[model samples]
Target: MRFAPLSLLISLSLLSFSAVSQDTNTVTAIENDITLKQADFDSFTEILNKHLKDESQQQHQLDLLRARSTKLEKEKNQALDAMNALYRRLIEDPSLDISDTKLRYQNAVDSHKTNKEDIAMQLASISAHRKDIEKIRIDRHALLNTLEGLKEQKNTARVERLRNEFNRDGTLEIQNTINCKRTETLAACEQRGQHLGMQKATKRFLDQVFANLTEIRLVEPKRNSAGARVQVLNSHVVNSGFSGHGNYDVNLSVTMRGDANNSRLCHLLNLDNRFCSEYSSSFQSIYSPQQSSNFTGNVRFSDPVTVSTTYPEIEKKSQTYNKPVVNILNEPEIDYTHELTLRSNVHDDEVFIDGVSYGSTRLSVQLPVGIHDIEIRKLGYNTFKKIINLSKAQTLKARLVKNKSHLVSKPIVETQISNISVPGMVVIPAGSFEMGDITGNGLANEQPVTKKILSDSFDMNAKEVSVSQYNSFAVETNYVTEAESGKGCAYYLNGEPVWEPSLNWKNPGYEQEDDFPVVCLTYNDAKAYADWLSSTTNNEFRLPNEVEWEYAARAGTTTDYSWSNDIGSNQANCGWCGSEWSNKSSSPVGSFSANQFGLYDMVGNVWEWTQKTAGQSDVAVRGGAWNFAPSLARASTRLILSTDFRANYIGFRLVKER
Candidate 1:
C-alpha cells in the first residue's frame, strides 16, 4: 500500500507507535521509505507553514474585532449612565419640564441596550466566523497532507483522484469563507448603526435637559364687586354728632386702572357705582359729632351788683281819654336779705367737673341757716369730701386740686408723660389685649374684645392733638395739620371760637397757643407728623392702634369708667353727657381727668384717633367725645368718619415706639 505523507504517517504513528517494532529486511524498505517520507515531510512542512500563517492572520483579525466590540460595550454603558443622570436631574428640578428630557433619555437608554444586544448578537456571528475559519484551517491542513503524500506515493491514479477531491474541497472552503466574510460585515454594520443611534440619543437627551432651565409666573390682582380697591386709611377722631367723611383711593399696583372693566368706591360712603376720584371732593374733610356743654352757677346777690335798682326810675303809664286811672304799683317794700356766698372745690382752667353741673374755679351758693355737705369731683381726678356747719351769713374758701394715684396706669403710666415741647405725645408699652367689643357692654363695639399681641412698644398722646399742638408742628416743619386748614374745622379766635373756611395752619386764627391738640388733619398728615418726629428726635413716633388704645384706656379695669361704673359723677368732660358739660366747648387734655392708664381725656373730650381703619369703609374713630354719652365713652367704643371732612368734636394724638 502507498503510505501517507511521512509527516502524516509520523503523526499517526505517534498515536500507536508503542505497539509496533523496527528491524533488518524492514531496514531496506525503511531506507527507501525514509527517503520518500523525507521528501513528503519537506513538502508538508512548506504547505503547513503557509496554512498556519493564514490561520494566524485570521485569528488576529478576530481578536481585533473582539477588542472593538468590548470598547463599544464600554462606551454604550457610559452613555447610558450619562443619560440616566440627566433624566434624574431634570426630574428633580422643580422648574424644569422633564418630558422631553425623559423621552430623549429613554431613547438613549434603549439605544445603548440595542448596541449591547447588537454586540451580543454579533458575538454569535463572530463565533460562527471563528468556527468557519478554524474549519478552513483543518481542511487546508488535511488537503495539504493529501497533496504531499500522493506525490511521494508515485501512484498517478491516486494523485489524480486526491487532486480532484482536494480541488472540490477547496471550492467548498470558498463558500465557507464567503459566509464568514458576509456575517462579519453584517455584524460590523449593525454595530456601527447601534453606536450612531446611541450617540445621537445621548446628544439629544443632553440638549433637552439643558433647555429645561427657565420658567416663572406673576399673578394679577382680583377685582371686587365694586371694581374698586377701597382702602381704609386709619381711625380718626371726630365730634360726637358729626358725620365722618373720608376718601379712599384704589390701588393699581397689579392691574392698570384704565384696563379695569369698571371702577367704583364701596362701604359707608357707598360710591361703588361711581368713579372713586369723583368722591374726593365729598371727602375733602370730615365733620366730627357736635357736642353741647351745659352750664351751672351759684346764684349770688351782692351790693356791688344791686346798684341797677337805684337807677330804675322811668315808668310807663297808660294813655287813655276821659276816665283813665294811673295805678303804678312800686316794688313791694321789703328788707333786702343779704346775698350769701356759696363755694365748691374745683379748678376752672379747662377741665370738665362732674356732679356740679357747672364748670367753675370756685363754686359758691347762698343758703338759709342749715348744715351743708359739699363734695368735689373731676372727670379723671379723685373726689374730695367736706361737711361744713354754716351760720346764716358765712363766707368759705376752698380749693379742688386733682387727686391722682387712685388709678392704676400699669399699661400706660403717668410717669411716661414727657414734658417735651412736642405736641400731644404719649408713650405706650408692648402688651396683649382684646380689641373691639360686643353687645353685652354699653358700647356696641366693646363687647368682642379680640385678643391681640403687640410686638413693639409705642407712645401716644394723652389727649387728641389739639389745635395749639398742631400749630406748633406746622410752624416747626413748615407743614400743615388738617385742623389748621380752613377746609372744615372750628377755630378758636381771640376769645371766641368760630368755623372758618380759609383758616389753616399757615393762616390760623390764633396759632400761638400750644396747648390744643392738632386737628383737621388727614391720615397722610398724621403719618407725616410721625415721620418728622422720628427724623428730628431720633425716636420712633406713630399712631396708636385700636388694641393699644383700649388697653391703655382700660388700664387693668374692665369697667365703664376708670374710677367707677356710675357715669353720674366720675365720668369725663363731655357735652350733655351724664348730666351736663357746664356749658362749654372742647376742654383741654387732662382737663377732665386721666383714666386708669393715666391717659387724660380718653373720654368726654374729643374723640381720639387710632391707627386702625374700618374695613371696606372710611376711617374709624374711638373713645367718646364731649357730646357723647358715658356709654359711648367706654374704652371699646368705635366711631367712623370720612377722611376729607372735619368737625369740632374730632381730634387726634401722637405716639412713639421704643
Candidate 2:
C-alpha cells in the first residue's frame, strides 16, 4: 500500500548510483595505499600456500614413516625372539652384523702415529662455511628497509585522499538537495503562471466544453439543511478511473446546499481503508506481546489476511508461547453445529442431520452458527457436498440421484420371452453359478459360493409384486395379507402371515400404493405364492436358488454393483443413502436401467429372498437393498433377515423354473 512517491523515488535511486561511484573510488584509493605492500604480501601468501601444501604432503609422509617404523620394530622384536635359539652362536662370535671398526682404528694408530691431527683439520673447514653464511644475512636486512620506506609514503597519500573524498561526497549531497528544491520551486512557479494565462485564454474553450452541463440542476431540500441534490440532465456514465493516489485531480463545484434532515443530494463514497484498521489493530495486539517474550517469536506477518477459520487463529495464538508452554496448557474450547442433507433424488434418499441418520425420504438439521461442512451420504450411493452456510436460517435439500462409474456391469444370464407380455411379470433365465462372493468380496454367509445348477429356465416377476399384482393374486385366492386383514391387523399366525403375502404385493404395508413392492411375507407365505403359480401354469415355479438370484442380479460382470457399480438414483432405490454405495440398497425392481439379462434392482433396491438358506435356518437374501452402502449390492453380496421381520424397504420377487 505504501508505494514510493515517483519524483522522490527517482531522486533516491539517482543518489544510490552516486553512492556506488563513491564507493568504487574509495576502494581505488585504498588499493593505491596498499600498492607498495602488494609484493611483500603476495610473496608471503605464496610461501604460505606452498607451506600448507608441504604440510599436507608431510602428513602423508609421516604416516608412511610411522608404518615403516612399526614394521622395523616388529622385525627387531622377531630378531630378539630368535636370539635365544642362537644364544650359543651369538656368545661365540656375535651372529648379529657388526663391523670390527675398533680393530681398524687400532691398526690405524699403529700404522700412522697421530689420530688427534685429523680432528683439527675438520674443525677448520667448518669455520670457513660459517663466515660466508653471515654476509648473506646482512644483504637480506638491507632489502627489508627499502620495502618498508616505499609502503609508508604510499599509505600517507592514500589517507589524505580518503579524507578529501569524504568531504567532497557530503558537499555534493548538500548541493544536490538544494538544487532539487530550487528546481521544484521554479517548476511550480512556472506552472502557476501558465495556469493563470491558460485560464484567461481558454475561458471560451472551457465554456463550450461545459455547455452540456447547463441543463443539469441542483435541487434544494424542502426544510432540512443537510445537503442538496445535483441532478444532471441526460448524463451518461463514462470511464470511471481509479481513486486516491493513483488518479489525477479534478475540479468540480456545488451550486447549492441543502438542509440536514431532507437533503436532496446523496453521496456514495468508495471507502478503501475502512477494513484496514480492524486488521492492523488485531495484529498489533497479538504480535506486540510475542515480540517481548523471552523466546524470540518468529511469526511476522502483514495485516489484512484471508484466513477465516478459528483453527489457524488458535495456532497463531499458541505460537506466542515457547515450546515448554504447550506441554502445560489446555486447548481452547469452541462450540458450533454441523448439518447434513440429501440432494437430487428425495424419495429414495435420506439425510443424516446433526448426528442422527435418517433413512427417510428427506431430512434437515438445526446447527449452531459457525463454520461446518455437511456430508450427504446415501447407502449404495456416492457422497457429495452441500456447502453449509448457516449464518442465518438455512435449508439444504439434496436429491440423491445415481451416477455410473464403470465400463461394464455384472451380467444377468436368464432366459427371455419373445412375447414378453405377461401382464406384469418379467421373465428371467435359469443357470448355474457360485452364489456368494467366492473370491472374498466381503459379502455375508448367504453368499457362500456353492455350485448350484438350475436345469430349467424360469419366469420371475419383473418387480416385487406391486399392489395391483398382489390385489389380483389376493382376489384369486380369496385371502387377505396381514397388512390388509380387517381390524385385528393379522399378527403372526404360526410364524407366517395369515393372508397370502402377494395378495396386495404392490402395497406391502396396505399403504394404498399400487406400484411399490410388497413386504411382510414369511418363508411359507413366499413358497405358497410360488406353489400356486406352478400349479396354475404347469411350469416349475419355485423360489430362485441364491446362485440364480446373483446371476440375474449381476447379469455377467463380477463388479460389486450393477448399472456400472455406481449406486444412487441412476441404479436402484432403497433407503435414504445420501451417498452412493457399492452395494447401496434397493429400488423398485426396474427403477434403474436393466442389466444385460434385463433384471432390475439387481445391485441396489430390496434384498430378494432366495430358496437357498445356509442350513434351512437363516433365510438367504440376494442383491443389496436401499439404506445400504454400494458394497452390499454386489452380485455376490448377501444378507439374512428373519422371515417374520418386515420393513418398508424389504421386498421380494418370485422366480420359477421353466
Best by lDDT: 1
* Residue 243 Cα positional deviation in candidate 2, in Å, after optimal superposition: 26
For 498-604, candidate 2 gives per-residue lDDT tens digits of 33434334344334345555555555556666666566556666677766677667654555554333343333453332324222322334554455555566655
Off by over 4 Å in 1: 1-420, 423-444, 451-457, 481-487, 490-500, 503-513, 569-571, 578-584, 613-617
Give model 2's TM-score versus the native structure: 0.33
Regions of candidate 2 where Cα sits further than 4 Å from its true position: 1-434, 438-441, 444-456, 482-512, 564-570, 576-589, 612-615, 641-645
TM-score, every prediction:
0.36, 0.33
For 1-658, candidate 1 gives per-residue lDDT tens digits of 0111111000112212221211222333545655665565466556655655665665566566567667666666666676667767867776766565556556656656666666576666655654554434334323332333333222222222211211110000000011112334333322222222212222222222222211101111111211111111111111011012211111100000011111111121222111121122112111111111111111111111101011112111221112100111121221112234435555542222222233444534433222334455554455555555544465555555654643333334333123335554444556665566533554333455577777775666666665554554567778855665435564333212346777543343333234554454566676687777667667777777677777777665556655545344434665334323422455556655565455777766666666755442235567766544445666677754445445455567767766
User: What's model 2's overall lDDT?
Assistant: 0.39
Kindly provide the TM-score of model 1 when superposed on the true structure, using C-alpha atoms. Answer: 0.36
